[model samples]
Target: MKKFRFALALALTAFVPQGFAQDVQPIDGIAAIVDEDVILQSELDRAVRNITTQYGDRADQLPPVPVLRRQVLERLILVQLQTARAKSTGVRVGEEEIDAALAAIARQNNLTPDQLRQQLAADGLSFSEFRASLSDELAIQRLRQRFAQSSIVVSDGEVDAALANQASGTQYQLANILVALPNGATPEQIATAQDKIDGIKALLDRGEMDFQAAAVRYSDGPNALEGGDLGWRSADEIPSAFTNVVGGMQAGQVIGPVRGPSGFQLLQLRDMRDAAGSGASQNVTQYQASHILVRGDDAAAKARIDALRARVGAGEDFAAVARDGSDDTVTSGQGGDLGWFVHEAFGPQFGDQVSALQDGEVSAPFRSQAGWHIVQRTGTRQTDVGAENRRNQMREMIGQRKLEDEWNRFLREMRSEAYIDIRPAAGVAGVTDGS
Candidate 1:
């Protein structure tokens, strides 16, 4: 997926010269209106061009231009609806947050922010446009998270079934390309999709194209932009249709053109691993630690932390120093005791520093997102592998599956409820049934 992002950058770069050659103004109008929000024809045209560029040589394999335009317009409507909904619910993202996300994307491409801007310009994309798109993406994400938390529920039976499957111990890192067949499609459509997938498989067999590239070009799955990456999953987590087939495949091997409810799917086994005890286990190290936090203006905070570290190093009791100097009111009176915690409980910065310490070792002052801190590791113990942890993991897995389903349904319902009016030039008047 990281590689795919870089590919996206390169693909956009190719559009620069052509974009510059074209007239600055072309006819543009409304594509669709979602409640108070509107999708612009210009935006739809750009999206179609992007999809074409991403697909490269395989662009011809896509649906008819009119069908593709409608599909893109529908997606835009969904996005506008979600963004509108987010604002109504008071979901907000700060400019700082968007900048941070852009910085991360730059870092992924090994470029500085300025360099990333230059790259975007070279790709014919204005920084402001890119930032606006990213902000909308983040807003949609926040909206989905809010909905998922309230709507998703996992049953005990689901957890038990998940655990039973986990007991098989095998897990796979898989990538897939799907050629989707619409519901109640005629035999001709099915045969055409099959033929398309067969051609894809033949290309894979001949090593004409890599899996990631092919997925970006041809996959109909939601993760197509991420090269159809499904991440790592245990057998039970996989869709039932591909479970047995993937179990029998080897790493770096491609399988399928397998028929399933949604469509014909081609899968590649990227890698695999085994969980402990022929089943899932959650045995992990837990830390008991304490910290002294100091917050002031930057220089003052640094000075105070330095002084506190010196005092503790000079044989002052850590608990005494923490009680006297720490800023965390809840833990300061308790001598900064954080109680027992798993590594993830405190996030990477705190967890990593604590993990590096031996029992009774005090760490050098470090800064986290919160502020400066000097931590003392008092003890460590391994958590027991048990049914409780397994059940918790199972619940999370089940919840994620339910979340995806519900989110899709939610989008469909939103589209159905919206008063959408697609203009004639947009070329998609009657095709979108909230699918």
Candidate 2:
């Protein structure tokens, strides 16, 4: 139930620090051979250690050694499979991108880069190893985004219905434990998955096992080790399979062995609350802005935008310069007029640029997916866009749900197609079942 990108990031956190080093180390025993890649026994040991470190005093809550090993190995296999797929599809992470990601990670953890390096060293990790892990993660992230953009389309009618049918402001804090079934699972496999889920449910119902521990031991979900935490989700983001039930469930209630596209899942309503602004006024400050976009390779585009910014700063008319130089044909002809838009109407990059500027002020050039741009904030006004904004929110939520479903199916397919051979000798007991 975890979002694709965030889950991808979490899944590999334990494995990231020494992943690359394990790849070329021939002396270590192989835990699994994934396509052309091998997951080393040493890698599994470090991953397990990292998980225990993460749990700290709660390490007693972790599953038995065998179950934990399988969970960690499966995660590592999936990461390898995904990164391989990303490479096949031509996704690449640049040095600059990795540098930016490192900084962002440091900032998020409230540590400067140097302090972050020190922390990693204290944990016996090297910055280069971390960077290697992040490189694959970034590539896989880009791959997922590209897949979603290409495959998921949210129709206007679907958004309209979602907006009409949903409660205005409710959100649920949910956790899930999934027993995933492979694509086109056989009747026997389905029954096995169902039984496993049912057993998990009985344990939960009888209070024989806590939900988080059950998840860590048995759930095949990406967030299993995180106690299968799905965090807070709006009704729009809930799959239709569970939407009908989640709304009626009380806090702490568990629902399902509910079969879904991915597998049999058990969902727990950890908590529920009204969305902060559900019934609040939708009045928001709207920016009237315009920009000159320069599309090219990153370096060239940045250079061009910077030159345009300097020209404008030297008393060149912004509109005249935009008309002559902007790469966005639709707006360039109209002197790059973007007209009126709210914060994030054009995405966070554009919004951040415009929002940080005063009226009539020109911004420094900034980069976005669309390339580079220098925006001028012409004016600002408070406008209510409640109806439109709600529709947009529904569309995003629906698209996200659909993407998760599709992406999971894709992963299953990838696993089915891959040549994976998990060795019993790799500390996994007699289990040798590998796709």
Candidate 3:
């Protein structure tokens, strides 16, 4: 069967179609040009409208129209650059992938595919247009994945050092506003950026404007429109230059105008959480479970799993029954003994089923991507995974930090090399030339 959902972090509201709604009357003019690609005025207008719709009651908190337009246009430009580069590098997303993503979106919003289409129609968006936009998003994601695989490498020594750094397992939820300076910025440009960042800091310090509001109005970062919310970061995940400074900050505290690869940034520590409590050991619960798998692609498979479930429910020896009926040749030969493994050893469905049962209790038949399964929980134990888990987490953290730095640099280089021209009619209000 086709996969029912995508693994992409696509939220219904957040996945607003990049294309215009069907009812947006066309304005016959080029808003901007990037290489051979041209952005139309109508597309810009629609993007602006979409952001306005997203903000709703908080729309009043948004920057003025001209500023918002410039922000949206820059985003569009980046998207175009990314998609074009992805295609040039042979990245492709098929129609089946787009269909699966659409189905996933529909399921997430509690709507059938037809209902989703109807809702899109009511909102003046065509289903086909939405599919195209989703395709671009998926392609760009795949491109990024490929880039991370090829460009970002975390060494074992780095992970070891991260583990050795005597720090507690604390994580911070952060937000930041960046006053960006161009690559190879002159003294005048640096002075101007410094002034802007200082002014923003002054506004935030006096509480004249909140961090989020100030971010929306003035930040030049990619997430400016989202109020510069960077989510959570562990000590290892933070940029090396700012780690010590951030570690010293308390919740609701703000710091910066600190210079980094991207620019001078104002950082805010919104909240913090202890990943593992102080002096607490990391332990994972493991389930000793066994399952009977009835593999097939049709109702016959479901019927077989149900019958096997009935046999076990009627007090037949589960191991004997599994040996006779289970299609998982590897485990079936061993009386279906799966051995002890962590909760996430198998997929979520298997873990949940096992976790829900008491020792020696069997679960109702369920389907997974593998096939239909009926699991029996044999026992459970808590195992300390502190050392192993910390090493793994540190490896991932180092990789993440590297990827962010590499990707930002890649984007800056791409933007600098691209041939871009913004028309006067595109409304460059409040935005400077060559900005």
What's each prediction's TM-score? 0.70, 0.80, 0.77
Q: How many backbone clashes does every candidate have?
A: 0, 0, 0
Among the numbered candidates, top lDDT falls to 3
The alpha-carbon root-mean-square deviation between model 1 and the true structure, to one decimal in Å, is: 6.6
lDDT of each: 0.76, 0.82, 0.83
Please provide, for model 2 over 1-435, each residue's C-alpha lDDT reduced to its tens digit, 9 standing for 90 to 100.
001122344335444435433233445778899999998888887777768767889988888888888888888888889999999988988999888887877777777878877776665555577778888888889988999999999999998887788766888999999998878789999999888899889999899999988988788898899899988999878876898889889999998888998899999999988786754558899889889999975677788888898899999999999998999999999899999988889998789889999999998888888888888999999987787777777888999999988998888888889999998756764257576
Q: How much is 89 displaced in model 1, in angstroms?
A: 1.2
Least lDDT summed over 10 consecutive residues: which range in candidate 2?
A: 1-10
- Model 1: CA > 4 A from native: 1-27, 165-167, 170-235, 238-284, 296-298, 310-317, 329-334, 341-358, 364-370, 384-392, 429-435
* Residue 261 of model 2, lDDT score: 89
Ranking 1 against 2 by TM-score, winner: 2
Q: Per-residue lDDT of 1-435 in model 3, one digit per residue for the tens? A: 011234574222322444435475757788888889888877777778878877889987789889988888888888889989999999999988888888887897788999878887776776677788788888888888998999988888888777788488788998899988889999999999999999999999888999999999899888898888888988888877779888889899998879999989999999999876533567889889888999985999999999999999999988998999999999998778899998778878788888999998999999988899998989999988877776777788898899888888888889889988888767756554342
**Which is better, 1 or 3, measured by TM-score?**
3
Off by over 4 Å in 3: 1-17, 20-22, 277-386, 430-435
Can you tell me which runs of candidate 2 are displaced by over 4 Å?
1-27, 289-318, 321-380
